[model samples]
Target: MVNDVLAIHNGNYSWNIAFERGLQDLELDDYALLLTSLHEVHIKVGEDDRSKWKSGRDGIYSVCTYLRSILGSTESSFPWKMTLTVDNLHRKGFYVTEWCYMCKRDGETNDHLFLHCEGVRWLWNTILTSQHMDWVMPRRMEDVLRAWSRKFRDKDSGLVWNLFPGCIVWCVWRERNIRCFEDQAKTTEQIREWFYMTLYT
Candidate 1:
């Protein structure tokens, strides 16, 4: 039944007439947004329809997983902990410059300051190289944590490995605030030292 609306027409995916008429009743912006949302959805031919819980393992849903997904098991981690980056502050009507305090080359966002900034990458690379591992940084902080979780699964060593990312985040945020508010700064090496100290203690 749902496939009827998402039917293939003229060798391309097109909404049926009924769906098109329903879309006409929406406001212009909502209609456009809905179309944009649907544009990438691919329909599989001759397959049974099924539901999936993306947050769960193997597409199997459980209450515990659902709660963790919404609650964010890593809420204390860097991804959700800091929200007052320069860009966010600017968006909230503050007058701070949005440039990153660490690199000063790009706007300060959660991802840029924590993951992709040149100085931050040095910090990450230092840790990764010490572990004899190579990593491609993810676009989002949450994704970084997830990828790290998958890579470091050893029970004995995993605890420290898991703590590495959060420690880096904490150290970077402290350095950022110090520079932003205290007119103090640390070299990338100093930050790396601080990260190791935080991770071990």
Candidate 2:
């Protein structure tokens, strides 16, 4: 819902913005609230859509649950936007300058930055292997996202691609930002290690 950041449900999320922001920056806890109770806010939304956020007995948790559902991650106790690879360079008043720093030919769109960048392609392979998950890196982020969903639709070989995607997306974006702002350099292994560290936390 709105890139995983829906507006407040009865002002609860608004009140917790600071705490949520802190957890996101630190890569800490992600909360999952059980939403329940509707119809009260209704008289408009039909019964089918109305009761989704209301589950438990009294449904006093409706507002928080509604907000969490909008976040699209019941497993995740924390709310996070999908990893954004696009640089803010567009805001600096230049269009042609969006080309990849490592691959001058391609624009630094989400697909290029996260998928086809020469350096990143190598890193992605390493990341998959280290995670002990069999994954094929697509030529573009869109392709990768599509394949990822299809691959993880069911469990196989004692692996769960579902659990790892969130961490993978998180780590890739972190590395991109590191190079962009910190002037740091890292190898494929280093990036994988970072992902592990973040995941365990």
Candidate 3:
């Protein structure tokens, strides 16, 4: 009966008839009229499914909402960390040299620290391989988020996939700080283990 209500893959059944039958099968006669009210809903065929963010008028997640979600009294978000990188710090009077604290092979930028550096690339590739995903790393943050959201369709996989970019951003930035301030560096295995432990529990 519950499966009847969730028969979204029933291509053989006409949409309205299937929905009405599903309601009757579930003994939801009380909701028959209410459910029928959704008949006017427009579903564009041959289009990718898009889930909207209820909080945003545009049906897309806004930066304000993202910031609110990840921010706490003591913690900032991944984007905030990227904004305050060593390169940006130099501009703001922190007087730090502009080199990726992670790899130190190239100048630091948010993209380099989060996505492009060889060490970061190795870390991301290892994680993706573990999940049996073969995604190409995007050069920009927005592209990465778009790819993750589009590719992972199942709830559990999508949730984990959605968190990976932000987690990697935060972890990589933290590792950069440890190298610069705490005089410590971590191997790729250590970083991978830390990410998995943080993600699962």
Q: What residue pairs clash in candidate 3, if any at all?
A: none
Candidate 1: RMSD over Cα atoms? Answer: 12.4
Best model number under TM-score: 1
TM-scores, one per candidate = 0.58, 0.45, 0.57
- Summarize candidate 3's per-residue lDDT along 23-80 as a digit string, tens digits: 4456776566656755555555445767887666777998876665555332323454
lDDT (C-alpha, whole model) for all candidates? 0.78, 0.54, 0.70
**Which pairs of residues collide in candidate 1?**
none
Lowest summed lDDT window (length 10), candidate 2:
31-40
**Deviation in angstroms for 190 in model 2?**
1.8
Q: Is candidate 1 or candidate 3 better by TM-score?
A: 1
Shift of residue 114 alpha carbon in model 1, Å: 0.2
Tell me the tens digit of each residue's lDDT in model 1 across 47-82: 778898889888999876776776576544333533
Candidates arranged by TM-score, highest first: 1, 3, 2
